[model samples]
Target: MTDRRVQKTKKAIREAYLSLILEKETPKITITEIAQRADIDRKTFYLHYDSIEDIIHEFGRQETEALILHLEQNDFFDDTADMAALFRALNALIEANLELYQHIARTPSYAFLWGQIKDILKVSLTETMGERLDIPRAQLEICAEFYASGTISTYLAWLRGDLPMSDDQLAEIVGDIAYYGLHKLISPPKAEGDEG
Candidate 1:
């Protein structure tokens, strides 16, 4: 195929893949179906992607990398930054790609998508807290996972229209949760004899 044809075929394959994902779970989507939807032959789909998972993985990787670059360029992970701004920017990114994100959130491959998102969040957290905390990577990973899972779950709920908060409101809530510490929310009661 010519270079233009190759690009067009790949684009069609990606669109079909996304459409299929939105309509049904990833496991239920088939290469033959994707090819049919794309108006391409199965052979052409193979020439582009090894499998459906490969396309999903590549999409996740490209989006994750681009997000990382955008964050860095905007100094989003800077120390002493206004986290509300970071959250708002993140909300904007998700809003801009609402279809892809909503589809991913509802798919069976959500764990894979969540894992990629968590890893990126870990990077940002490490940058923000590494020097001050002087924590090992293992411990930092635990912190990252804790916060990332909460954030992802919340965002997924929001994407599904379960959460009624607007973007700025959600951002404020998430920022407070991140900075205010969870101990207060899940603290043990003090014994009567315990000192203040």
Candidate 2:
């Protein structure tokens, strides 16, 4: 009975947090507002979180985890895949919690949220590139950092209105770059011996 009550109380708190965010910017909302919305007192709120920021982090963490799982559910890790769907996964995340993220991105906890994103991408990339990439330790770390930053930065660009492209289009474009690599940037000199 105690466990069930705790679960119910936590659920109420989470749902109330979402409610408040959807209703207004996260800043305008306060612990009092959330506690009231949860139909609980300030004591209960404190029992669950050290601060409002802690609850906010919990919310973003849940969102990032859900995005990762949804990607796995759709078999986004299929062998020979280009990992384009990962971008789509990100898009789905933004769309799923559009209001919340829009607000959180403006908060001081934005860096923590980004850290979660990087961790998720690191796990997924390692799974996808396993064995196929016998990269050196240095190169492996560099590859993960480059592609993870590229993905996040590209998504941020889309969010900030750099491109009018939809999530799918953005995903395809980014995926192509990942799959084709920077080789296309080089020019080939035509030679007599090069003719097949």
Candidate 3:
């Protein structure tokens, strides 16, 4: 286990970096700025991280691990997983980290972070769903990638105000799409003589 003081220092660094990212693009952020904001000297900052990108990468790694752990604890990979409940749990996790997610969503430079997270989820989903489903591994992987990418992209859109829906509503819609596909959401064409 890491020492408490080390953990504290790392937390400070991460918080400082996140705050800086919110103000400007990642490339414009400097180690000096992070050290100053974190109230630590340059040497101390180097002790904890190599650069701003390191902090960002660490944040992505930590959040991805947290997501996987959360899903596992919630039985998200179980054979009888409850799609609705799983999505609700996912939304709750996202809500809990709304600021971080919002930062990632609005910052174009952080797009790769989101992509990395989504790819990890796709792999996990592909492995588990493959074992459960009788379909070929390649097809299952494609399907998992589709669902994982679509769900995360939709959540990002919601975060950016493009969806303008509540967490519960988003979760419900995502769950529906996962279980029933787009056909469930689309209405059949109206007859020519149909009236409102």
**CA lDDT, every prediction?**
0.78, 0.76, 0.82
Cα lDDT of model 3 by residue, 56-164, tens digit? 8998888788777877787777743556665676677678778778778987888888888788768777877777789987899889899989988988898888998
List the candidates' TM-scores in order: 0.78, 0.80, 0.88
lDDT: the better of candidates 2 and 3? 3
Order of candidates by lDDT, top first? 3, 1, 2
Model 2: runs farther than 4 Å from truth? 1-4, 19-28, 106-108, 182-196
Better of 1 and 2 by TM-score: 2
lDDT by residue for model 1 (54-146), tens = 887887787778777777777777652465565666687788778878777666547787788778877787677665687798897788778
**Poorest lDDT segment (10 consecutive residues) of candidate 3:** 79-88
Number of backbone collisions per candidate, in order?
0, 0, 0
Model 1 — which ten-residue stretch has the worst lDDT? 79-88
* CA shift of 77, model 1, Å: 3.2
